[model samples]
Target chain A: MSQIIKQEKKRSFVTAPTAALLSLLLPGLGQILARRVQRGLLMFGALVSIVGLLVWRITLLGRLAEGFWPTLFKSLDRAPMFVAFGLLAIAGLWLWIVIDAAKQTNPNRQFGNSIFVLILVVFFTIGWQISEIDLVKLSSDANEAWVPLSKILWPWEAAVTHDTDTVEAGAKVLVDSEGQAPPVPEKTEGEPYLRVSPRKGELSKLDEDNQVIPGTKITVYGENFEPNTRTQIWWSDSIGNEFRPRYQGEYVSVMTDSEGSFEKELIMPYRLIPPSAKGQQIHKVMARQVSQVGPPLPSQPLILTIELIIETIFMGMMATIFGIIFSVPISFLAARNLMSTSWLTLTIYYLTRTVLNIVRAIEPLIWALIAVVWVGLGPFAGIVALTIHSIAALGKLYSEAIEGINPGPIEAIQATGANKLQTIMYAVVPQMIPPFVSFTIYRWDINVRMSTVIGMVGGGGIGFLLVQYIRLLEYKSAGIAVWFIALTVAILDYVSAEIRQKFV
Target chain B: MLEIKNLTKIYPDGTLALDDVSFTVEDGEFLVVIGLSGSGKSTLLRCINRLIDPTKGQIIMDGQDITAAEPSELRRIRRKIGMIFQHFNLVDRSSVMTNVLSGKLGYINPWASLLHKYPPGAKKEAMAALEKVGITDQATKRADELSGGQRQRVGIARALMQNPSMMLADEPVASLDPVLAHTILGYLEQLNSESHISVICSLHYLDLVQRYATKVIGLRDGQVVYRGDREDIRKMTDGQFKEIYGEEAVRVNAGEFDQGEK
Candidate 1:
């Protein structure tokens, strides 16, 4: 160490002092003066890039600030920790570069880059804060995710329903004294019966503030119902529209006694009658007891899920068939090896490649949106969208496969005095079969996955139903669609793998 | 008979592949070409069949200028001249019988060949050619399934199906073992002697050149530097050998080592 310090002191005063002074002004200037051009440039570039990144981040954090200085200060106020560390890193780098510049002029001293690593660690920490990485929230908010995740994981309960048999009896009631009420029907044996006392009553009405006012209460008597069974009270308006009436925030229901008889009281429900009616509006009050019967059947969501999933699969199949038909020819035009023979053919190759790239760059959902307008929202539109995208994707893949083929057989075939078409048929076509089949199968797999998503843009598949269920807050039903898509994609992936293995 | 006059091929990249090369081969002559890699040996052989169009040359075969033939006429001449490669360029996925039958494509109807419906006797001809190379039983196997020697035999069979007037072998034995090299060359020799087919083949080893060549030409830097008859080749002096190969080139013992190989 002493020898190094003594050698550093003994260095030529003229060049060494000038080099150190130049490096103090700019971080890499001394190194450049020492003829370390590459190392100096690298140091300069790293310093500029890191400082530039820090400035960009600061600007992003304070975008709403008025001007440059205010924005910088405002960003510091908002993210003090990131800004503080960023400034500290810049200062540390500046000091380190100044020391390093002086050290570069000393022949006996070895330069160390450990300070650069320290600067990087400081900036990386600032980046973590700027990106808002929060592992605490990830675990803390997991319950919120699980609420829907559980529904998605197991949704079969909503997929089925039980058939039920109802035993019901009704009694008529008058809405007001302005019209006459219907007479009560005679009670019969071995059947349920309901009778309402003092049937003439006012229906619940909205007041001046539109707040609901409770109507008159009436006692209801029931008999011949199933013993110890719960019976619900339902009301029908003058037009025969039936709905369960809520009493005190709960549906009006009562349990029958052991003798199959009971009595209960319920306020009249609110109903608006049109002024055009000439006679009394007799609303019916009914007591109904329900019993589940037979096996569970598929619910509407389950049936719709199955139907749309099948449509999605067929859309993929049709798209793949159309893609294979169109892409096969286009691939020949796009293959560089085949088209590079002449400038005219080379132009066609570039044109085809550019068009394929443009078409493939657009997502299938975007194509589906355009196709929905063209074909008016059906599986055919989804097929058209997927086919358009598939053609571009498969064309590029097939052309690459063509480019990768062994040229030996092609030369051999040409030497046999075969025509151009005959050469392709015998030499290129045989070599292309395995790859063609593999790519086609792989494309079909992609098309199937894309078809499910295309339906969300009105292209007619399970995704349409899935979006509707999600918007309606039907998590279990959306779960069914998600499950179907996942299962179908997995199965198709396996099938394609098997087919590829068999052929390739 | 064949005649090549002042054949010169300059590639688009300005590579002088063949520089004013001139040679002649009469009927029933086994002419062997010896050279280092990139010495225009393959280029010279390919020029005879018009596979590589010469930049400037005259390839006169039976009073017809092959280099000046149109596409249709060139193909007609190419079918009469069979060529084999060092790599045995058979379609790996195709059956040996199919590969051999394809050699008759020049004579078959275009549409019929496209549909793979050859003339009735074409299969018989392919089998006969295969039998000539002693691989008729392996005709049903795919070309890639065969051993190196067997694949070369298949190549020979495919070439024989053309019934050509001459054969061009471009380093046909380079990729095979020394023993297999003699086996493949023996087949070419049998066809040459039995059918009077003029054979123009490029070879690497000096012993093989001396054993099979009725006449020999050596090339260096795409120019012919040495010519000798069978007896003259057997008695070639070191100075003559150095004239064809560079001064730094040393001939290793007998058939065990390659000479002037890259």
Candidate 2:
């Protein structure tokens, strides 16, 4: 009988190689043979679910893995690199499990410690692979970003331009190449009895025959200047120092005609006196061709930054106020103690708590998107979004505060034969006020910070303007917005701290 | 006078806190109930005031059946029955005056109470109650600001606001220091004798029960096992004590009578 028993035992027994081979067939088959039924099932579940997750993630990316064969190849090409990396992670974990199972029939009792190393390896490798972590990208991208980033960090130049045209003039007489004013012209005989010495037809205005006044236009004509070049007419003082007449802010240039000569009416400046000619003023017209020019700075965008910062602060404050109004009563419903007396109350308690949790779980930015759709994009949308999020956060805090108050007072009030409402007024509300004030101030502080994020999603605050500036490549304006936001938040944080300190 | 006729109270969890227990208290008598922790002493006192409804019984005070009182009727009945507690359950956040004034809620107008505006006349009465308990100075202080003895005084003053004819103190001195126990009970004693108000108080120590009880009822397992006047309990035998207090129970002050038997 003993020999028969031994023979039966040998037939049922599993060796290391057999166990390893079994695990190769199915994830936890070897562990099952080793009589670790619970562990085997758990490992099997994990392997199957992780593979299922990988397939799901692949499908979610629109890699339709149709018809097992063609999809097997094409889907791999279409799926993100993460799926392949995930498969590798599972392969590593499975290999570790197979080797571990082969070492003993009855493996280590503590499943977590025994398998922790492989589990960590799987998680980190998949995380690293899926995220496409590449330090080289950061290094290469940093160099490209430095040009704009440095300019943003370095505050912009806002200097005013003060440029003018220089002019000089000298009076000239109408003379021929002999350099002498007309004298007796040629044998003045026939006309000697009755003739004025007449010039040919008429001398041009280039000879300065017209008188000019400040703030009035005068005709100035010139010939033989650079062709098609930008030229400016200047006012020449009696001291021979020439300057352009200021039309609006700076000198306005006129282009020369293609024939290398130009004629135009020019406006006189409001003031034309030079240092040497302060008492006695005289003027002359001079023209020069300009080759290059610069533009005056625009200050419209700078003023816009300041307006947005104020809007962001008010948006946060409004949201916090709305949150407080809605959350105070709702918190009492969520409090476990008040609702513990009846089954109906307990149900309402749990329902209120679940709703709060669900609302809180959704981020304020996502809420902002919904609010933008509802309210049509502005600080109003931001306020509504922030209010919804803050209600959930502050409700949870207030409920916890209610739950934490000592029950002695409540029972004491009840024993006085007071009604429910009286008990709450006399006892519960007092205990709640201090923590309520503190939490409210804290929530307002949080909401102010949240408004910046809401603005990024087009909820209309400084964050909205900040994103616009960055997108439009106006880094200087964006930098100004950042400064406004940082300074406002920091100051509010300190002020709220002092307020909370007083209440607490 | 108060009468508890076959009073039975079963808690919501089906605990038979009091099972067919019956007792009575004459007007102006100090009736002390002695029992173990769960011996139905608290249930009996609460049932008389209908703070806890009896499962099957009749609680009669003066000619009214308290157990059958309506919601509005119960409040009126409760106004006359002042209840004190082991923890001196004053609203700790409220002013001591407010805590005392709440005892007059059953007598005040419901609308006025809802508005939390008590009559000035009621305020004067609450002050008088505080004066009676020697805690008139603590009237404006928050209830939690006082020592245990002072808090119990506040509790007593709150009960006095109703001008109650009977007081139910359920282990009132249980949470007090051993030395301060009699001091708290002394005020209850004065209320019973001088004001002619009946008191049904539960007590722990046998020596205290003997000192203050005009009459005593010993309960064991929610059943009345011993009954006596003040003098009879003072000389109670070990066998009688064991019947209510249980075997292996040696009185802390039992002295030679217990030592001789052991």
Candidate 3:
């Protein structure tokens, strides 16, 4: 030990100028020359990945790529400042590497110098450029963005149509007054409601008692929607409050036929009525072809945001339930102590552990894409993706729980002449229940968060709705959906923590 | 009555844990087996209940060849024989009552057992067993919530629920303190005398063996080396015990055994 310590104490020297030159050529080369292998590898990896990201973005977009290495050749004709910003970050890392390598020759010297302030300044400047930040736009153009943003947050203002935009959006109203509300096939309440076209050019919206079941599919066809515009169909309860009919997610975006007309079917989304609605099921089918010319009724956007948020929450819940179902048995198989008894069992244990690790390593987003392919693009795909991910994650936790169980009870149960199943129930299950519950709750929390983003891959959740609105720059409705996601996540986090406390 | 003509147990790994052990457990006999840790006392006790299948043996208990019994038939035989452990192996997370009621699992319908629904008659009997161990008050508490002595009492209660004709206790008092050890053995002694349930118990201390045992067997390296009645064991000298236990072994609390408690 003393000899090793003495060897470690001996100092090695490198020329500062030579080290800096090496780093100047390659971001972490000087650090490697200075015998800082880990530091060199980290710096090298970060710089390379940053450059790779820039190349990928520029090449994939093709806007700035008439040739290879556009920035190196053209110097200033980039499509977005963010690509330049990414390049700058790489340069920043390179500068840090050179400075750090030079200081390595003198172990007592600090790496940071006055140049760090310059680096910081440049970093912030690039960040601002990439973000396209404009103080003037914040004060002036904020009005245009805020009008829609505020409407999305305070939904009734933009969602409730003062005119018959819902009817004009897609529906052909064949019945009016008494015929619209009652004496139609669907269930009716006290007054008249706007009836929609159930088939092409036919307007008998009601079924038998004038009431549509929660899962009932409604078809709305309309003429004179702006040609090639995307149209949406929504449902509203008695008080003129509208909700988005998001089956899996936002009704797979129907576009109007080039003649400016559309015919589409959408399911009446479940849990559309809040408990506050007091059992009122009198619903109206309305549609709108999204046109560049006019803004939607404030209430329509507001309600759709709320509806999509709730649907995302439900999607997360379903995924968690499936996660629990699949994880429980796999956990027993995966537990080292339970499955390491014999050669056959030991082989199974390693196989189970390896498979679990592989599944867990893949992000839910990638799983969602796979799920979309397997099941088609809907909330079902989202559920399948999150459930698959959740099973692997929760299986690991449950296996840890099984491995931690006391051996005493197992022996005791066996001594009492209990069979394998009885022993597991009497001994193993009791020890496992608390941890199982805690893991399930924790998995549910994670699934909820994953489901929100899963929609981007067509997994049918609020994330799908969120990505579209963000792409269209409709920040108002987007802001409302973001609020719902934030609220749901916050609630789930609190509830899971409380549940964990109880179990633990 | 149980008869062991020639019982041998060789582990899969080739460690001979028991060899050619032969003994008869007469009706209501409190037979104490004494040996050092690796002398195969545990293997011997387990073989009777078939917890560890003997490598070769014919254990005739009440005219039935237990070694020849099928898995389902083995369970029927096991239900008649209750076993206790040194670690008081009660499920720590389950209630004391639940642990005790587990002893009745063999007799209960498998489906009902899966649902953890003990018949009302079984519940009433579990309470009676707890009363016998003087821990009826702790029945609803979790098994681990009790102190070591109390936990052992729960272990006894759980075994008592079986209403077995014979009990195999593998170093039941090994993990307890001196005072608790005697108290536990006293309960076993009382059960042996009162219910006339034959007990084949492995013990550690000389004083405990002398106090509780009606007959004694001493093992050394998987072979039975000495056999004696209560009086012969009580009169055993240090030199005589050395022959059975080996020269390296030391006696513990030997002087305490001479003065009889009862």
Candidate 4:
């Protein structure tokens, strides 16, 4: 009988690994190899169903080209074909493990340990395959390319431009004589005339000679200009219209040298002329200097400056400071350590918590609006909103932190003839520092992000610029603004994390 | 130093934890109240400090009736009479020094205490108490970090920090092993001897009680079944032990008592 038992054990041991191998090739095949056909089919069916669902969803979303579908199908599409092949493989593997587990004989019971390890290995292998099988990625090339492309194209830019003709007297100018200027002069009498003179246009006035006149002469000089280039000039007499070149004269334009310094003689327009009879007007002018070829003008730099970001940072900092100052004392009332039986303390705790929850529940923008109504617009409103919200949020967190402190020290301090307040200072406060620092830093991070958001409602931040860009349909600039915000938030998160780790 | 008259405690669940029990402990006496588990041992001890207020009794300590005292007055009384628990009830996270200092809290103003400006003397006193318990070296260590024996010593130090006229130890060594248990009892005995501070200790170990107690009191189902000298206890008959511990207890101890410490 003992000989027969030994032979049976040997046979089972030999088959276990083969069964495990079969299961690895196809899920549940090991169970079938182990003579549990029902369980094997159940597992096989579940895996196929899940894979099918994933593939179907991926295809529905038009992500098939990413190979998500194909991978899943390859693993499952040839239902009968792959299933039979996979089942056979898994059955072989399972048989191997079982046989190995059975072959170990020990009077000391170490055989149980070996069997457990083998079982763990088999489960781990099955799990790995399930996780690695990518049905969606197998379906579509488009999705495959788009997924990675989307990450790289996270931010986009757009250009915005506005035209302006006003020029500062000493600043450089562009002279466009043929386009939108006074009619060209017909060389009438020999009044030695200057053409295209470097000139400053008088504000809301006409010049002598019935032509719109330029203002004070500022020497417009450049490397390419001759000393005589500033001599010839042109003027216009149209009221409220600045001087314009009647002819492409020497004084009509001025170009700066490599050092950006220029010298030019400009005809000053008379300011004594009546302004426009209808409304306020601005006189315009251009200074051009003739050269062998016109020097390339520099393109105007795109400016996307916003004061809202600065305002938000300031508001957030102020709010955090005020919040800390105001909330710390209130937190003591809520802490069970300091006041154990005072109903007044309990009331204060709930009241502060409720107010805080209400403040937090409403978005910061709404708070900004409310604050604006109460305190008026600008940083003051933002500060008030952030401070109010911070008090509630910081209060709750601080109280909980105070609560978690070990009671032993409090009791010890109490035993020392220290009163309630003394115990709190010596016992509770010391233990609370770590969590308090951590929570405060985290709150500041959130406040920074919130500061930007609150700017949309005029609370003052980069959000204002983002709103304007979005409204103006400058999505590219808006994208740039969004990038700034995201970058700021990420940096803050990292910095805060570092600070919390170091201090807390 | 302390008087407990007609003290009875009934839990809210309608269970009679202590039935109209009355006892008076003289100053400087090492009084050990012995009983099996759930025999009003702890309830009787807590009643002295009003930690667990007796339902129908008056505790007159130092000529003041505490049973009718206001919350503030009760707190004042509590400060003067320190109570130790079986679990040592030391805040586990606090340093040993801090736990000892808490006993002096009742003497300082709340706001002053909040600032941790314990009069310099209080600090010295706290350290002295720790020294008394022989755990002065562990003053900076967290209470939980200490061994069970050390933790209980801290508990004693905490009680001593109160500078009370009387100390109430409710099964102080019930949680310790035999050796640690004896060491703690020895400390309490030594404290009683040197300070002449009245002590009312509840205990389960009959051996310890017989060894250290000047007087013995036994309770059965919230009623005092035996009260008197240690000599009177030694003369108790099998019937009396049965009355206190029930008949099943008698049968189990019939043979064991022969070898058991009387």
TM-score, every prediction: 0.86, 0.69, 0.64, 0.55
lDDT tens digits, residue span A1-504, model 2: 243223322221477788788888897788677665555676777777677766655555445556654555564676546657676778877887787557546333233345755565556655564576887898988888886677567634421232443221222222111234333223332221111122111222222554433344455554555568777666554456666766566685667678655566545444423335333233345566544335654355556766777788888889999999999889989999889999999999999999999999999999999999999889999999999999999999999999999776665555556667766776688788879989998988888888976899889888898898889987777777777778888998999999988765
Q: Model 1: how far is B201 from its true place, Å? A: 0.9
**Model 3, stretches more than 4 Å misplaced?**
A1-3, A6-298, A337-345, B237-262
* Fnat for every candidate: 0.59, 0.49, 0.74, 0.31
Q: Write the per-residue lDDT of candidate 4 for residues A1-504, one digit (tens) a residue.
A: 244333332222225556656666676666555544454565566556544543443344333345654644554553434333444544554454344333322112222234334444544544544466655666755676554344324534233333333222212222322233333233334222222333323332354667754554534333322334332233333343445543234335544445333555554434454433333232333333333334333222124433455566677788888889998987777676656556887677677667767876877677789998998766778888888888878888898887777654454444334445665566666678778888888888888888887867877667777787667755556666676677778988999999899754
RMSD of 1: 5.0
Error of 1 at B235 (Å): 2.0
**Which scores better on TM-score, 1 or 2?**
1
Error of 1 at A29 (Å): 6.9
lDDT of 3 by residue, A63-95 (tens): 554676664434335444565666666677778
Off-target runs (Cα >4 Å) in candidate 4 are A1-310, A321-360, A391-441, A469-504, B10-16, B33-43, B62-64, B68-79, B87-95, B107-112, B141-148, B173-179, B203-221, B225-262
Shift of residue A379 alpha carbon in model 3, Å: 0.9
DockQ (C-alpha based) per candidate is 0.62, 0.37, 0.51, 0.21
| lDDT values, one for every candidate | 0.87, 0.74, 0.77, 0.64
* Candidate 2 local lDDT, B205-261, one digit each (tens): 787787788999988777888889988988987678777898867776522222221
* lDDT for A53 (candidate 1): 85
